[model samples]
Target chain A: MQYKDYYKILGVERGAGQDDIKKAYRRLARKYHPDVSKEPDAEEHFKEVGEAYEVLKDPEKRAAYDQLGSQWQTGEQFRPPPDWNAGYEYSGGFSGDDAAAYSDFFESLFGFAGRAKTGSTGAGFHAQGQDTHARILIDLEDAYRGATRSISLRHPQLDATGHVALRERQLNVNIPKGVYAGQHIRLKGQGESGMGDGQAGDLYLEIGFNPHSIYRVDGKDVYIDLPVTPWEAALGEQVTVPTPVGKVNMKIPPGSTQGKQMRLKGKGIPAKVAGDFYVVLQIAVPPADTDTARKAYETLKQAAGFNPRQHLEKQS
Target chain B: MKNHDSAPTLNGEVLEDYCLSLQQLCHGATAEPEFILQLVEYEVLVPQGGQEAEWRFRAEDLARLRRAQRLTRDFELDLSALALVMQLLDELMELRGSG
Candidate 1:
């Protein structure tokens, strides 16, 4: 694993005081907090900052880390000297459920084996597994119809040697139909494995939809732009509109104009309180390139006595 | 007609209509009841009943309280300050969502 310069990550000096480190951490955390930050790499940077703070906040962990010598370069292949942490006592053990968010470098040093909470479950030291969160992207059709997705998760495992190792586990998750964006699907007993016979924590999967070329979805509502000939828009006509389910014959009311929206109720994502699908009519005017088409247009323009720019002229 | 009943089905229930009891909210957030009670005290989460046993929480309550808890733990902010932070963040998210 490459060496991480925690000091550089936090923008602090080697001899920086604990107060300085704490202030730096607070400032950086506020700036890069994933919820508020709009930066593209905000979450990754936030995790890195948190990991750096995790090591530096505690003096014991910091002392051990400093003993590695400041001369070492960041991203340089690093292996801790045996017994580097021999003298120091890690009083404040890893207590948070976010150990999985920490890097492998952090795990190699302060991971379970040498840390206070290492396999020492002792008798009656049971603990439930940590709840894991992930985002699942599915096609719009998947939301209309349920789908089974295979997802992989990395979790800390307690091996026979009492070493903390990250294990990749895969589970086939069933995504229920009509799941809207930003909604979560809870899968019981599917997160990190519980320690010492405790019940496993549930996995929370946030649903997101892949961008669809033809349809825009909000909640359960779906929208599509339907192209209609100018003649069809001018006169009422029975048209076939494509919906998530399939094509259905729809009636275009008389006097329908461009940018008119028609709602097809109960035709959206199928579910209780089903949302409506909207069809926005876009008038497609025929080009008068050919002589026959020009003659037809000329005949209609003279006979119809319609001034399309009357509204624009009024507005100006 | 097609026979596809052999496939295992997954039933997903939407967290609407005052769903999610207090206990489930606590479990989902991996937070203690005491902290949530404090949130209720600070007006962060307002449940129906005064008594803890009769109190109920919505899925939104779970999400907001968990967000508050994470911010507080990560930034070491107090509940009241974090409540304001949560409020601003909520407004920002709504604006971004609409824009």
Candidate 2:
């Protein structure tokens, strides 16, 4: 395991006082907290900061850690000497339900004893397990046609000896059709198992959509940019457009401008209320590279005599 | 990684608006009824009903409550401050989404 420098993680001096350490932790927590922060990798940084605070906040843990000396650098190969913590006694074990979020270095030093204490229970004790939450990404097409997904989850579990270890479980889940983003799917009795005769907790999966090349989704509504030739926008014509379900012929009214939006009702996501599919027209102008194309453009310029900068000219 | 194709498929119930009861919300959030009641008093959660026993919450409430719990714990915020923070966060999310 690599040594993690708690002082470096919290950006404090090794000789810093408790008050200084606490203030630094609060500042970093505010900046890196997953729920509040917009920074990339905020969750990872937040976990590191939280772990640092967990050790630094407690006087016992801090003193015991200090005994290791400051000669070690972060990410350097590290192993505790035999009976490194023999003289120190920790009053309590690690707090929080997410001990698995900590690093191997942390678990190697402090995880086993504290976690074992919490995992142990008297005989015939029955308490329901804690519920679990996770987010799953599905394809936009899967939302329309309902697909089966195999998901793997890693969680902390206790062995027969009451030692906590990370375990992975896989489940094949059937995602129902018409599910939209921000929705939850509850799988009963699929979460953490109870200690004795208690029931297992439920698992809640929040649904999110993978970004699609041709489509953008907001709630249940879908949007796509449809490129059209200038003539198609200027003159009325029937054009084939792609929708989530399939391609359908849509009429482009005469004098349709660039960025004009057309709505196909009940064609977005196949939800209970059914969102609408929107097609925004993007006018693609052909370049006058060839002589014939240049001539055609010249003739159109002469015929139409349209001044697009009239408003700017009037303002000037 | 082991093959999971032979595993039986589990169908989950989609949690829609106003589909969760107070009891279920508590279990989903890992919170106590009194804490939920405090949230209701703070207007952080607006369940549909007159009494706490009869309240029905939206599925989204579970997520909202969890957020509230985390912010309160991390920041040592009171209910009033937490309520304000929640509203500001909602507005911030709206602005970001639209932009």
Clashing pairs in 1: none
Per-residue C-alpha lDDT of model 1 across residues A15-76, encoded as one tens digit per residue:
99999999999999888988778888999999999999989988889988998899888899
Q: Tell me the lDDT of candidate 2.
A: 0.89
Top DockQ prediction, candidate number: 2
Q: Which stretches in model 1 have alpha-carbon errors above 4 Å?
A: A15-20, A113-119, A124-133, A192-197, A225-240, A249-260, A280-316, B1-17, B41-51
DockQ of each: 0.26, 0.58
Q: Worst lDDT window (10 residues) for model 1 chain B?
A: B1-10
lDDT of 2 by residue, B1-99 (tens): 233877888999999888888899888988888888999998999999887777889887888988998898888899899999999999998888656
lDDT of 2 by residue, A113-232 (tens): 788876768899999988898888999999999998988899988888787788988888889999998889999999889878999999999888888898988889999899999998
Question: TM per model?
Answer: 0.79, 0.91
| Candidate 1 residue-wise lDDT, B17-90, digit = tens | 35666787788878898898888888888887667888877656666776787888887889889778878887
* Model 2 DockQ, alpha carbons vs. true complex: 0.58
